[model samples]
Target: MNRNASRILAALFGVLAVTLPFFAGDYPLQVARNIMMYMALAITWDMLLRSGQISFGIAGLFGIGAYSAILSVIRAGMPAWFSILFAAIFSGVVAFVIGFLILRLRAMYFSIVTLALGEIFRIIIHNLHDFTGGPEGVVIQKGVIFGGNANSLYWLVLAGLAVALAASFWFEKSKIHFALTAIRNNEISAQSSGIDIFRWLLLAFVVTSAIQGLLGGIFVQSYGFATPDAVFSADFTLLPLAMALLGGVYSTTGPIFGAILLGLASEWLKLKIPYGHLVVYGIIIVIVILFMPQGLRQLVRRTSHSADGRSA
Candidate 1:
């Protein structure tokens, strides 16, 4: 019964997401796009977390992809559409090269390195004045993809999100799942079990980095510009991390649910308490972490179990 209900809900959501442009206003579509983008990011973050590796470099890789896409279009004369693809490949390659160096670091050591890498990426871009337009950023002379049509732009981001969702689902269902779970549960045990820890961790890092880069490319193409500060904003990392934590980690549905709730709540807070909204938002997140560390998914499961017990 629960499985059937979930399928029905999933189908409804798909229909609504696909048909949103037809009925929703431009503003709503824009907000939906933002939510979807972060939702994708949250899923990718959780993907890596499944390996017990927490990355703080989501913004770094995302920014790399954003800049790569924009620069390819500006300097290399690549098409806007193709540049996004280039971004993903570029980011994946970067992760693959870096993985050998950093994937060996476990726990907070890996997390700190990832965080610093993002800062390093930002600084490099900041100093590249002639080619990258320096800290001021660069704009597409040709303008945004799709001529900035809101619906078209929304769909572009949605497509990126769809890729993220597909990859996440694959991770959850494949042998990769068991590999990561074993690694997370006990790296030593996993190693003894013939699971190459480095290999699986590297794969997760590369795949997640690639998706983050893809999303960044989509963002730049949609907006038609990329600034070091904007593209490398900490929000890219923190918000998605928070969303995944809030929704629950280790599952695709967790991040999606978290993003939807927090994304809408964020907009509402901004409108109602523009000056203090961030403070309130942070407080809310802290409270959730303190009291509901397992997140909404786990909370719902507990509630459902309680109700069943009562009926019994």
Candidate 2:
């Protein structure tokens, strides 16, 4: 799409998003907030995937941020705004240290290690009874920013989505795009072309981790409590992965589209089969991977092309 068209579409979407809660009821607004949060997570995950790195530690870093934010608020009595910043920094530092070791690995090996790291984080939190309240987790007495009402929480999540969208757009448009594309295509070639593959990969990892952490902080604050299982659950990592893959991994629009579709489906599925909704998600993932590997975005593009060709 042309730049003008893209800008216009984005503006329209922004206005619609802002007006969503005004038209929708409380339940719908809550669902919209969840969709935006997952969209942010999916986009951030795709941002790192652009660098040829597939991480399973999204929930780990996310949990780190939640714990950091919660602890900061509970222990130090810091303002909620400061907690968000602290959580992001904490996740970034952890990513920097972990990326050094894990970035050395490639593909499936890297994914496995990251997954293991996530479990390790959960176990650590589970055992830290004094600080984290063990597996029970911590609760926030004060509400989220802006007094923690549903509308306030919805706007907070929207702001996070906006930030993630801007960062993703900048990354796609800047030199980092070339660096990550090069790395994704061929690390040797990228290095030969002076891309500093490790540095770029590390940068992507840290940035994505920080964003994940920020989202986790928002999740905990919005709900007013956190537990190791809830914060570090595989659901966070897997759902976003499925959303990105089902929507299309390399493009920004893919995750947003996928999140909107799957997020609503997920809610309805839970209502119908609360215990088996995950099974439905798994089935959808299987079908998409097996038949529509290019994702729903590609399917739409192909359909549009066919229709245009027929008209012509």
TM-score of each: 0.97, 0.94
Per-residue C-alpha lDDT of model 2 across residues 193-239, encoded as one tens digit per residue: 98888898899999999999998888887877899989998888989
All candidates: CA RMSD in angstroms?
1.7, 2.3
Any runs in candidate 1 off by more than 4 Å, and if so which?
Answer: 1-3, 310-312
Model 2 lowest lDDT segment of ten: 1-10
- How would you encode candidate 1's per-residue C-alpha lDDT over 1-312 as one tens digit per residue? 254665686678789889999999998998999999999999999999999999999999999999999999999999999999999999999999999999999999999999999999999999989999998999999899999999899999999999999999999999999999999999999999999999999999999999999999999999999999999999999889889989888999889888988899988888988857668657767977898887887777777767777431
**Candidate models: Cα lDDT each:** 0.93, 0.87
Pairs in steric clash, model 2: none
Candidate 1 local accuracy as lDDT?
0.93
